[model samples]
Structure formats: C-alpha cells, structure tokens
Target chain A: MHASLVVSGLRKVYEGSGRRVEAVRDLTFTVDAGELVCLVGPSGCGKTTLLKCMGGLLTPTSGEVLVGGRRVSGPPPGMAFVFQEYGRSLFPWMRVGANVELPLKQKDLSKARRRELVADALESVGLADAAGAYPWQLSGGMQQRVAIARALAYEPEVLLMDEPFAAVDAQTRADLEDLVRRLWRQRGITILFVTHDIDEAVYLGERVLILSASPTVVQEQLKVDLPQERDQLRTRVAPRFAELRTHVYEQIQAAKRGEPS
Target chain B: MTDIPPEPTRPSAWGSLPLRVLFVFALPALLIAFWWLTSDGSTNVYWPPLRTILRTFPDVWTRARLRADLVPSLLRLLAGYASAAVVGVALGTVIGSYRKVRAVCEPVLEFLRAVPPPVLVPVIMLFAGIGDTMKIVVIASGCVWPILLNTVEGVRAVDSVMSETARSYGITGPARMRAVVLPSASPQIFAGLRQALSIGIILMVISEMFAASNGLGFTIVQFQRGFAIPDMWTGILVLGLLGFLLSVVFQLVERRVLGWYHGLRDSSRRSS
Candidate 1:
C-alpha cells in the first residue's frame, strides 16, 4: 500500500529574541498515495515553514501531520526530505555512492542489498558513473541529482522536496523538473514539492496548492489537467498550461497585495 | 563533471615534482650550509665546532644512552599525546554540542588555557611526583587545550543543513556523531592536533628538565652543567631531528585522513 501524507490545521510560530511571528498560520491538505503535489506561494508566504512542519523537521504550534495514518511528532519513518541547499545537505567528505547509501545503513538490508539499491538509485538519476566522485566535484545540477538519488536509495514512501532546483541555472532546472516527473511516474512515490515558481508548479504537479503571503494559509488549489505523459516542449506550450499558469500567477499577485483568498 | 579539468590535488603552483621537492628543501639546505661553513674549525667555549658536535653524536647517543633516554622520552610523549587526543575530542564534543556545558566550562577553560603549561610542571610534580606520571601529565595538560578548544570550535561550526539532513534520514546517536558530527569537525580537529604535536614535544623536554632521572632533556642539561659542550650540541641536534621526523610522519597521516577535505577546498577555490 502506498503511503499518503496528511497535514491538518498545521500552524507554526517562531518565538525567539522577544519576537513572535506566525510563519504558517493554518494549513490543511492531503496528498493522496502516489500523487505529486506542488505548493507555490509569494516570496514570504512560508511555503518552507509549512513543508518543514509536514516533514517533521519543525514542530507545529498546532495540528498534526500524518503519513500512512501514523502521526508525525518527529521525522516519520516512511518520509524523506530533499533540502533546497543540496550543497549543504550532502556530506562533502563522502563520495556520491556513499552519500546515497548513507541513509540505507539504518535499514534492515544487507550490505550487498544496500549496494544494489545505491546502484539502482544512481542509475535512475543518470548519475551511475559518479559514485566515486565527491559532491563538490559535480555541477550544481548534478549535485542536486545526487541529493535526489540519496532520497531515492532510502526507498521512502513519501518524498518532500523544498524548492530543490532554486539555485541551479534555468536549463538545469528544466532538466531536474523532468527528472522528478520521470522518477515520480516510474516509482509511484508520493511527492510534496514546494516552490515559489508558478510555472514550475503548473508544469510538475497533478495539483498545485498556492499559499497566501506571511502568516500563511492555503489560498487555492488548482488541478493540473495536462495529460499524464507530459514533456517540456509540447505540454508547456499547450493552451491549457498557459491558462493554468496565468491563473496561479494572478493568485500569487493577489496574495502579495493582501487580498483575501 | 568530466568537462571540468583534472583537479590539482597537490599544490601545482610551483609546477613539476622535482622542482617542488627542490623548493621545499632549498631554504633548509641553504641554512644548514651556512651553519656548516660558519661553524667549521673555529669553536667558542660554549658553542663547539660543527665537526666536533658531529663526531660526538655517535659517542653521546650510543645504543645504551638511546635506550635509557630517547626511548622512555618517546614512549611518555606517545602516551601523553594519545590521552590528550582522546580526552580532548570526547570532552570537546560534549562541550560544543551543549550550550549549558560550554557556558559553565568556558571561563574555567579559558583561565586554564591561558596559564603557560611549563609553569605547571612543578605543580604537577607536587601531586604526581618526579616520575613518568608527572612527565606524561605535563605533556597532556599542555597538549589537551589546543585540541579541546579546536574541537569545540569545529563541532560548534558544523553546518546546520548537514545536521538537519542527518536527522531527517534517521541517523541518530552514535551513528550521527560518526557519520555527521565528527567528519564535519575533523578539519579543525586536525588543525588542533598539528598544534598539539609540537606542544607535546615541548612539554616532554620541559618536564624532563624540571627534576631527576635520565631523559633527553636531562642528558642535555647534565652535559651543559659538566661542560661537555660537544655532547650538549649533539643532544640539541637530536631534539631538532626528532621534531622534524615526527612532523613528517604527522603530515603523512594527515594527508591520508583529510584527502577529501583538501580536494573539496581545492575544487571550491577553483570554481569561485
């Protein structure tokens, strides 16, 4: 059974240094098993806060996140997070293969089985030959692929990505987006991707959840009706894609202007 | 990744292996040559001729003397250095990991660190007595501060993202410390170790000079008092040679342990 991720009435407030700011005011959403969902918002909309709370990296001030019906007080067993800062997330001291295999060391798998999973994950991410190379030896895009490969090797049921491609160049970002879609289709791993890029959310997800600016709440959830077998060239240029992106873009602008959802 | 040029893992700034070796040895060779020529036949009462000191080297550092002085001195150095390293890293990790521990320990650590370790030789001897225990404790007391302080700084500076990444992946307890904390802190830790090596040698000699018995420092002081000028110079030379040899070994070990760190730094430097 695929594990579905649930976040209900999640609220997070940062309290420190005599200042209290509500980062994620109220967020309620459910990403069905094997489904890909993208969260988009204005720059200060607390998409990261919401994602961190859901991933159990940060404690919510209220409500709860559930993966496969089990409440997450801390990082849940079936979940994995792909940080936006791949350069920091990866251990510079470890080679690509070792970085990928690190998470699996905690699992019940044998050493041979762990190696097999590492190889398969690297092969899937088009980084099979980079196993011996350190993370800094590769390009920014390749480093991110290694990070994704690391998550994949863990065989996690729920993958949470926090604007993973934000630091790469435009061309590399496109390639990574396609890589995510391909991996999602092949593996059927439930993914919750967070980004501020409206077009990226439209191009990648089955559904896009847009968030309001700071002290955030879900502004809207728009269904992406593009055919399942989508590609960069044709799908992006489709009339429906334009309408959907424009709608999401307008909603983000409205959120920035303090308009009610 | 392949498009990137081959990394210059060793510093290639000078170019060519033979030339690099030449550059490394050039200054030391010139200095030694100057010493040999200047101190050739002429001799002061205190400063013997270079040839006299060389001749006395075989006589003064015979197998018997080496066994009595050099071997015990080295063993004590090794024991003290090993203990300092273990305690420094262990205690430093705890202090660095916890704010309350660091807060309580900082003032005391700073006060103790500020006191010159050689001055504590008499104080340590009072407690442990004039024996191997006192010498090892003296070496350890001096050596631990650099290592402990450096480990604390290194552990404190471990990147937050790396910590979060480890935590998210279910790497906890000893696994987390091994896979994440230690490696992250090791570059600084090695720096501390490098500093401690020389300090350990200094303390070794200082502790020996303070009191009774046979050791390299004790032998040197005895030669000086008895006016065996040439033998004294030989003892000084042995200490210098010992320091040089230990340093060479330390570098080899460091190269192996921190190969990845150097590679990472070099690549980052080139990219930026």
Candidate 2:
C-alpha cells in the first residue's frame, strides 16, 4: 500500500474576540492510495478543522500535510473535497454538466476529454439526464450527486469528504455511501472521510479512526475485517458485524467518559 | 408584452394567475384612470386627461424631426449606464475584496451617493460644455452610485463556504470570480442594475429638461411654451409609459439570466 497522504504533527489556532482557540493539535495520520479511512468524532470535535488542514483549505500553525510525498502549502491540485452543504457546494448558476466540468477545466485536459469526463461523472452519480439542469432545479440528493460528480470529474488522486451525506435523507445517504465505496474501489483513489455517524463510518471505511471530542486526539484505528462485498440486509445481520459495531460503540463511550482506553 | 409575463411562473398556480393578471394591468389602468379623471378641467395645469394625452400623442410620436432628439437623449442614457456598469462592477469587486480599499472608498462613495444628481448637472455642464458629452457625464455620474453600492453589497455578502470550496479546488483570481463570486453575487448586482436603470431614465429625462434642443423633455417644454396642452400631456404620458416598459423589460431579462439564482429559496431555507 502506497501512502497518498501524510499528516505530521498538524495544528491550527484561530485568534479573535480577544482570545485564542486551538481547533486541532498534534494530529498525525497517513492514508494509502485507494485506502478509505473514516474519521469519527463528536460534534465540534475539530473534525472539519482537521479536514481543512489536510486539504490545505486552512493553514496549520506548526505542521505539514504531505500529498503524494510533497508538502501541501495550499490546496494541493491532486486532491478534491466534497463539502456537506450541497445547497452551497455546487455553483447555482452553472449547468450540472458545467459544474462537473469546472474543476476539470483547471486541469490540462483537452476540451473534448473534459467534456467526455464531465458526461461520465454525471452518469456515474445517476444524474445523466440532469446535465443541462441547474443545481437548484435538482432535489437535495441530486444536488449532492452533482457535488460528487464535480469532485469525481477532477480525477483527484485523493478525495476528502466532510460529512458529504449529512444533509440528505437517510435513504439517499445509504445510496451515496454505497456509491462512494463503489467509486473508491473502481478508481482506486484514496479517500479520507470525516463523519459523526458511527454506522456510516463502520459501513464505509476500510479502517475507522475514532477521535475524542474538544481538543481531539485519535482514540483508536479499528480495522474492519468484514468481507469486501457489503449488503444492507445480509451483511448487517452477521455476528462479526455486530461485534465490530459494539467494539466501536464502546470506544466512543469510553471517549465520552474521558476513560482510560 | 401581452404574450409574456415579466415575473417567473412557479409551479402550483394557487392564486398566482390572478395575482399576475393584477400585476399586468393595474399600474397602467390606474395611470390612465387618473389621467381621464383629471382631464375634466385644469384643476391643476400640470395634470392632463388620458383622452387629451392620447389624442396629442401621435403629433409627437409621428414627427420625423423628434426622432433626432430622442436618439441623442437615448445615446447619452445608454453611454452613461454602460460606463457606470463597467466601472462600478470593476471598482466594486476590488473594494469588496480588499478591506483597506473599502474603508478608503466607502466614505467618499457614501458622500457622492448622497449629493443628489441634479447638483452635478450644472457642474458637468460647465466642465464638459453644453454638448451630449455633458449630458452623458452627468447621467453616468448620477447613475453609477447605486450600481457600485449594490455590487459591493453583493460581493461582500458572498457566501464564505463557496469561496472556501472554490479555493479547495485551486480556483482563484479571475477564474474564481467568473465561476464562484460573480454568479453568487449576481442577484444583488442585478438589483443594483435595476435601480441604476431607473436612475438612468430619470437622468435621461432630467438632462434633456435641463437643456436640450430635442428629446422628450425638450418637447414637453417647447409645447408648453406654445400653449400646446395636448402635446405637453402627450410627452408626460410617453415618459410614464417608457419608465413602465423599461422596468418590465429589465425584470424579464433578470429572471431569464438569473434562473438558477432566483430558485435558491433565499438560502436561509434550511429552517423550513
């Protein structure tokens, strides 16, 4: 497994209102290429701040983010981010095809290739017919799909998603999670997914890294030994699935109590 | 005008049809009714009846000579509006992006915005001379503030999340403005444009009134001097009609251009 990203001792401090707030501290992690890892934590646990640092959307005070072995000073060109607010993530004025096409345009791809990629990305999200439709015209699920298509069309080496399915309905969230898994497997792109949903993390991540709330620290990284193929019904009912979920749940409980692991 | 509505047609017609029908007919009908009632006698010489105005309208509308005057006034209005849009948007973007620029310019712009357009007419007339250039300068100066102020508002109000998302994609500079910033700010910018257009029309009519050999304003004054009441009424009615039609046309274009934007539920819709 090749490391697609390396975060070493990352920290971010924001100053305002006559005070200082440390959002993240002493964070270190590495994601291998084509490896899907989910960061699970309580709300306001600096999960977003950590993602921003990793993606180069925010600067860290005294640390570095390495993408494909190069230190990321600003948003690294090879990584794409899918934000939670589908309402805001996609540009409302551009057509769905154009929204997906925008990031690709930044790449050195030819116009024909760009067009082909945009078309394929939209199709993969089950939004093939929505190419000409604007972002506002689609339902929430469809809008999120457009956002995904935008990230996918960039053909980023690593896709960092921050609660990408939180805003959508539960049914849509399940479908989207499956979609992410399929895309990760098919493209072999590294993924760093941040979510507060324990089931979602366990269901989607090859490895789930749980963190403690407020001044977050990594509590544990649990390897999911479930079979490669997953199902909503059959797989969820298995004994190993329950055991894995219980173990992750206990870790979270321990985190909440500030208990020694 | 009869075939199209200026406002968007939303799904579910529940009372929307009648509301739109009222929007279509109310203002013009009310204006006409006022003209008809007032024309009964010269209760106030400034006001004239709809019939008298309608009868006198053709004399002004049909005259081949009046077109020259109308054309010059229109040219001045368009030049001023175009210049304002270009400069206002350019300056607005800069001022909006940079805090220091905004702090320096905001006070000066506010003072300019407050100093009514009529005061500038005389000053511009002196500097630019009694030509179309003077009128254009005055009109452009008069019209620019609203567009600039509104552009600033739109740009300042840009959703930060969108900007961050754009940055994450390595989108910056002009590409970011074109793709992310401009579209996000457009609804507000167009609002400014709409207001500027209204001001432009007012300045168009006013500049002609201040001093012009032709144009609708000049025609009104010239007729009043000759005691052509009907002709005077005709010119005023024409001004009213032009203002109404211009607003409708603008709204139509705004809706078409901002189709994606207007549908966005005013954004705080998450609560609903």
Please give the RMSD to the true structure for each candidate, in Å: 1.6, 4.1
Clashes of each: 0, 0
lDDT at residue B47 of model 1 (Cα atoms): 68
Residue-wise lDDT of candidate 2 within B183-262, one digit each (tens)?
Answer: 88888889889989989988888888888888777777888899887778777767777788878888999988887766
TM-score of chain B of 2: 0.87
The alpha-carbon root-mean-square deviation between model 2 and the true structure, to one decimal in Å, is 4.1
Q: What is the C-alpha interface RMSD of model 1?
A: 2.0
Q: Please report, in order, the local distance difference test score of every candidate based on alpha carbons.
A: 0.91, 0.82
Q: What does candidate 1's lDDT look like per residue over B1-272, in tens digits? A: 33433544566679888998999999999997888888887758886678788988999899999999999999999999999999999999999999999999999999999999999998999999999999999999999999999999999999999999998999988998899999999999999999999999999998999895988899899999999988999999999999999999999999888888998888888789
* Per-residue C-alpha lDDT of model 2 across residues A1-261, encoded as one tens digit per residue: 779989888878888999998777667878888899998976787998888888888888888999999999899999999999988778878888888888776778899999899989877878877787767767787788889889998988889999999989999888888899898888888999988888888888899998876566777889998888987776678898888888888988887776646
Among the numbered candidates, top TM-score falls to 1
DockQ of 2: 0.50
Worst 10 residues of 2 chain A by lDDT: A132-141
